[model samples]
Every structure is written in C-alpha cells, then in structure tokens.
Target chain A: MADLIALDDARDERLRDYTDLRDVQLRTTVEQERGIYIAEGEKVIHRAVAAGHTPKSLLLAPRWLDNLSDVLEATDAPAYVLTEKAIEQVTGFHVHRGALAAMQRPQEREPREVLAAARRVLVAEDLVDHTNIGAIMRNAAALGFDAVLLSPRCADPLYRRSIKVAMGAVFSLPWARLDDWYGAPALLRELGFTTYAMTLADDAVSLEDVEPAERAAVIVGSEGPGLTEHWQREADHRVIIPMAAGIDSLNVAASTAIACWHFSRR
Target chain B: MADLIALDDARDERLRDYTDLRDVQLRTTVEQERGIYIAEGEKVIHRAVAAGHTPKSLLLAPRWLDNLSDVLEATDAPAYVLTEKAIEQVTGFHVHRGALAAMQRPQEREPREVLAAARRVLVAEDLVDHTNIGAIMRNAAALGFDAVLLSPRCADPLYRRSIKVAMGAVFSLPWARLDDWYGAPALLRELGFTTYAMTLADDAVSLEDVEPAERAAVIVGSEGPGLTEHWQREADHRVIIPMAAGIDSLNVAASTAIACWHFSRR
Candidate 1:
C-alpha cells in the first residue's frame, strides 16, 4: 500500500530523485551516490517490480494510477500524483508513458556469481553509450546469452534511456561489472569458458568460421577505438565478422547481435 | 569554387535550410517540399558530395573551413560562414559537428533499376525512425547487400539524423522508396528475388533452416506491430530468428543485421 501524495509543485524537495533527469552527468552522479535508478513507463515499472526491486517512490499522472495500482499495492513506497504538465516540469521531458518509478539499485553482483551457471556470456569492454548498452542487453537476452560482464568504463545499463531502449531487457538479464578489467579475459578462461574477442585485426578468424564451443564468451569493445589492445591480446581467440569490402564495420549493437545469434545454442 | 560569405546574423534568409533543425515536423515538411536535405558534420558532408549530391548552400564555422576546403573547391555553392554560437542559434541546437549543408535531393530510383543487378537486397516497410533506417542501411551495406527498398511511408534515408547514424553509409548505399507499397512484395518476386518476411508468427520457419538462394530479399516491418498482414501473406517465406523463450523479439535493426549476415552470399 502506497501513500498517495498529491504534489502541486515540481520543485518539491521530496521529488529530487526525479528532477534534472535530462542532465546525464548530474543524474549519473546523483543516482550512483544514492543507489537509485529510474524505471520509466508502465511496462518497465512492472518489470522492475517483478524483478524484486524495491521502489523508493513513484511519480505519475492521474491517468496512470489505475494501470499501476497493483504495483503500488506490492510496495510500501509513496506514490506522488501530479498533473501531466507538472510531471513534465519535474522530469524535464514529456511523461508520454505517464508513469515512472524510482527504484532501489541493487548492490553490485560478483562477476563469478553471474557466470556461475552460464554457458554462453557476453563481455562488454568500455562501451560508453547508454543506448548501445541497452540495445546489446536486449539482443543478448533475446538471443539466449546466459549472462553479461561489463568493464568498469561501460555505461550504466540501468540508465533511463538504456532501460527504455532495451524495453526492460536489462531487468531480466543478469550482469556484473568487472573491477579489474585487465584480468577479465583470464578470469573467464579459468571459469571454463572459451573467450572470443571481436575485432578487425587482419589475422582474426571470421565469426562464421569459428566452431561453437560448449561454453563460450564473446567480448566486444567501445564504439570508436574498439577493444583495447591489452584486452584483445589477453583473450583466447580473436574473431571478426566478415564484411563487404570498403565498409569498415557494423554498429556495435548490430555486430554484437549477429555474434550472439551465431554463438547461441541451437 | 565556393563563394564564402561571412555572416553575423542568425536570421539571414539564406540560412532557411539550416533553421530550427531540431523541429522534426517543420524540417521534414520544409526539406521535402524544397527537394533538399541537410548533411551535418564534415564527414557526412564529404560523403554526400562524393555521392554526386550537389550542395545548394553550406553553413559552416571558420574552424571547419580549412578541413572542407577541398570540398568547397569541388562545388560552386555559396558557403555561409558564422561563429559557432551563431550556428547554434540558427539551428536551435548545438552544432558540435561545426558544418551543415543543404543538398539537392537525388531523384528517386526505380525499384527495378536498384534491384536489377542485385543478388541480395533489404526491404524496409514503414520504418519511421531515422536512426533505425540509418543503422539498417549501414548493416546492409557492410554485409554486402546490393541495395535497399523502402515502403512509401518509410522515413527519408537522407534525413540528417539517419545520415549521421549511418556514418555516411547512406551516401554509398543505393535506396529508393516504393511508390506502390501494397504491390512491393510481388515486385520483389517478379524481379526474381526469394522474399523472406521477418515475423514472430508461430508457423514461421527458423532463419537458420532456410537454404541460401541465388537471389534473396529480407523484408522487415516497422518498430511496432511488425510486418503488415498483407506483406507477410505475400512474402515467399515467413522466417524467424530463434530467440529465447519469454522474449518477444530483437530490435528491428539488430534482427535485420543478423538476417543480412546470414543470407549474405559467402
């Protein structure tokens, strides 16, 4: 049961979690420091609740209250009701979906725990775009990758934009950040997974030519510079997706999708 | 040689092509009605020029002039020089790319002509998002697809955001809008292409199970609602990428990338 608080002012101090969301730098810092992330829209809010996340609070227009009544009933968090215009003023964007929840960010998971039961996993090294991270998470989950590991520099998968782009795939997919990025490849190898570093090096074998392994992990890199040389050198093997001449490469998300689909167990 | 004219005012009538670019409705209507499209940044501008698109005019900062000097020598279009702040004011958004060009939109190519020499092609139906269309173009080109065909309602491939996201792949890729979308599937078949309609229908066959053909075309629908019933019924085969249970589907761009990579001639 939630306490339905009607808010008339967008600048209310209690609404701090939902303010300045369009400022990525401010939100990233405030969110990490406070251990909270935002779930936008009805569907994503439902997913967050189903994933066992606790809600710190919710901000919603009157129209969304009924649709989210069950979610409110499941937690004791306060639900703030605001007019659509006031909600927009608070969030700094149109609340098109008409609902949002401030969820408690779960403590970071151990990389080994995420990979313990996994047979196929994805390792993202320094991917900095929230949309790209979200898209990759959706692809990995839909394509049947068991889990994911991210280098410390990777963008937050739980960012509002990332969650929206992923359509809540980030909630269901198990992922962990690697504190020691330099040793990530060796750790996966020791856990009985063969590692494939995706790259464009001339000597790299084509993704189509690589045989499926019983337990495999694919490592992808950042947008511009791609996989750092140290990470590429440390992986067990380098794999390249064969592309048409002259065109350099596919966008990171698209390329990762192809690799995930190919490596997924039939 | 381009005529470089210095301008201090953001309200110059000559800058109509570059005004309020952040307003999608206004720009779409204006650009199409005028038979022109914008090319942003130095790289995209260069690719647009290389693809034989004549620039009507260019809006640039002094810093970008030196880098674009060669392109200037190639075009007789007048170039308007402004400060970075003025460029931002005129465009209603920060011009981080520092250059913009209003280019003459190329005449639409006939589907038959674009597909005549093609063994592989991609057909996008009603994809209204510029980013998705751009990404799909990049994937299709990198995977060696011969050309692309768009439904009449599809977003313009030459839209600035699409061109930027595609990393100028749109300039190199041959694409055209179908004047008659209802007859599109049949047209592909008539041109001797085995059409594969991407869908989530239970009766659809796995993409991996399908054999490579002499000539193939993959049809992808819009972001939501997927393929129209008409297109699905008319396609030669309904194909689906095997996905994990409980997940609906991959992003249109990602699924299309996997399809293009799989159906590409090895």
Candidate 2:
C-alpha cells in the first residue's frame, strides 16, 4: 500500500515535477530531462495505474483519497493529501478533476517490433499536433488497432497535454518513433504488411473498395499537406475515404478514426 | 473588387474585433453578440469564401495582398493591408497565417427544417467543448450526415473557434438548435425519423445490429455525463458501438463518426 503524506505547502520540493506547467518551454525541457509526465484527472490516473505505469506520487485532496483508496492500495507510491487550494496553487490552475499522478516515461518499442506481430497498425507521418496525436491513439486503442508508428516529425505522444487528451491510452498503446523514413516502408512490407497510405488524390482507391488482408497498415499524414507524394507512390495502396466533393478533407485525427474503423472491421 | 486600405496604426478603431483574443470571456461575448467570427489562415478564408460567407474585411500583410487578389475579386469588403509588425500589434499576436477574415455568421435554419428533408442527421446534447463540437460536425459532414441538430445546451456551431476547427463545415452543413428538448425526440419522429441514441448499456443493440432505416438520427452526448435519461427513453433504438472490454467508450465525436459511417453505408 502507498504511504499517505499530508502536505500544506504549495512550494514543497517533492512537488517540483508538477510546478510551472503553463510554461511550455520549461515543461518540455523538464519532460526531456526527467523523462516523466503528469496525468491529470482520476479516470486517466486510474487508467495509467491499470496499464502498469506505476506512479511516482499521487496528489489529491483529502476528500479524493478515500475515493481513490483502491488505486492507492494497489501501488507503493506516496499519495500526497493536499488541500484543494494548495494543489491549485502548485499546478498553476484550478485542478478540476480532484486527482493527479506523475509517472515516469516508459521505454517505447521499436517501430519494427511494434509492427512485427501486428495485424493492423496505424502509421502517422508528421502529425505535429499533440491533441490530434492523442486523439488518434485513443481511437486506435478503442477500435482495436494493434499499434501506432510515428514518423520523425510527429509530436511526442507522452507530452503532458497529449497524455491528458488521450485519456491515458498513450500509456497503453504500442507506439514507436521511426527516424528512417525511406527504409520504414520496406520494413513494413518485409513484415508481410500491405501499407495503405491515406490520401485525397484522384486516382486513390476508395476506403470502401479496399479489400482487407491479414496484415494491413494505414498511413496518415499532417493536417494541411497530407501524406507525402513519395509515401503515396511507394505504399502498397493509396486509400481515400470517399467524401463530399467541395469539402476539403476530414481532420487528420477524425480521418485516422475512420480509417482505423474500416481496417478493424475488415 | 475589394478596396485595399493601408493601415499602420495598431490603435485603429477598426481593429477592435481582432484585439485581446486570449481573453475567453470577452471573445465569447463578441461571438454571442455580433454573430460574427474570425476565420484564420488563407485556406480557411478561401473555404469561407467558397461557402458564400462574405468577408466583412480582410486583414493581411502587404505581401499577401497580391496572393489574395483572385479571392478578393468576388467580395466588396475592404481589404486592410498592414505590415507584419502592424498586423501583429493590431491582433496582439503574430499572425503567422498572414491573413484573417471577419465573416458574418450566416442565418441558421430551423431544426425541423434541417431534419424534415434530411435522410441522416447528427443530434448533439450538451456537447459544450467547441473543438469536440467542431470535430463532430467535420466528421458528420465528411461521412454523409446530411444535417446536425443541437439541443439548447450544446455549444454554438457558429463560434469562431468551432468554425475554424471544423474547417468551415459549419457553413456547408445544415444545423439548428432545439430550444425545447422535451419536444425534440417527438418532433424527430413526427418528421419520419427513427432516433438512435448512443449508449453503453449492456441491453443496447450494437450499431452493427441496428439495421439502418430510411431516415435515422444518431444522438450523442457530452463526454462525462452522457445523454439525458429523458432523451434515452425517447430514442426509437439505443445502439452502441461494440468496444473492447475495459474501455468505457470512444470519444463522443469518434463514436458519432463510426455510427454515422455505419448508417451511411446502409
């Protein structure tokens, strides 16, 4: 069982990891150096604990401690009971969720390893928005996508905002960074996967028309300039979600959900 | 042709609408009162123009004026061309998109009118988050949802951020508010529509099992507290997207997409 520590000072040294979060640069640097991120809200904290990402410490109001007794009992981390006002002061915002946990970043699997045994994988290329990345992971996890592979330009999935937005699915989903863009396609093909690059090109096959195979991968791109021409040309198939003619395209994350659902159904 | 006016002063009274945007309450008031919103970026501006939302005025760097010449030809709204520094000063931030348009909110149709002729519609109840609302609309539009109907508690579809996040689909798709929630489900049925409320109850039929009818309305709720019991009881069918065990539910917007796509296919 976790030790329950009472804290009244907002500036306690033990709470340094959760301080000054509104400063993006400082937060990013702290995340990079310490390799940890904060998960907000009781649901997300519970999810993180359930996924085996053991928290370093849990912070909550006295009222919440009883509610989270089960979660706290399952772990050896210290549960810091703080006044709601103190927590708000420390976190630099009103903590609406009543509970939060700071957890160390876990090591990510290699892209090849994440894809090796996968039947359906989502490959995100240059998806820079953290919220979109988080949303995609949540959708992928819910819809039964086996893994997510991120290109070099994609935002960090374990970022604080992404973690919050993903509802802690980022901790559970198998995600890997692929730096070698040129060789990644070959690796997927070697894994016996048919890579389906999502694009809006005229010649691409509609998502409804694409036949489902045993192992398939869906590649999504950044919001504005979608999948690169090289990727579209090199993939095993270019799949298009049939859309209204005048409409530009669905948002990247929404498109990812649609593609994942299609592939999962198949 | 639009008149090109040069403005070097940040304190100009004409630039009042573009100032202090980081203040949420002030901006919300502006959105509520004026029924007008700002569209950022050249692409979104172009989309607004394509959808027939006339630009009240265009604020851009002098260099972008030449690039926007063709788009400006159709509008008589004054185009304010300012230096990058002046534009930044006026908007209180660096306008990286190099252009912004003040668009008049188009008149909304009655919910009955939108539903009366539509084969498929999306109904949102108390979905307060603008981004989620926008994402839902974008998904609905992309996946063949003919119209969107919002209950009284739902977010404003015409809010500036919603319009931008939706990629301007709020202009393209038919949408309206239901001031009286008690009468909504009955009105929907009266319009020859079968209401399918999305829920996670064990007894609810899977979306796959709910055979699509001629006209169907897929109702979704906010993230935390789902659809009201009143609305749930009124639904002709309560359907759920079969999710993996341990996962509570997909995001409301994503679930709506999956449900919409299933119905669209039928």
Best by TM-score: 1
Local distance difference test scores for all models = 0.91, 0.84
Relative to the real complex, the DockQ score for model 2 comes to: 0.57
Q: Report the C-alpha lDDT of model 2 over B87-129, residue by residue, as the tens digit.
A: 8888777888889888777777788788868999999999998
**Native interface contact recovery, model 2:** 0.57
Please write out the lDDT profile of model 1 over residues A86-140, one tens digit for every residue: 9999999888898989999988899999999999999999888999899999999
DockQ of each two-chain model:
0.84, 0.57
- Superposed on the true interface residues, model 1 gives a C-alpha RMSD in angstroms of 1.2
lDDT per residue as tens, model 1, B1-266: 99999999999999988999999989999999999999998988888888888999999999999999998998899999999999999999998889999999999898889999999899999999998999999999999999999998889888988988788888888888899999887788788999999998878999888886799989999867999999889998999898898887898999999999999844
lDDT of 2 by residue, A134-220 (tens): 989988988888899999888889887888777778877788999897787898988899899999887899887888789998999
Worst 10 residues of 2 chain A by lDDT: A244-253
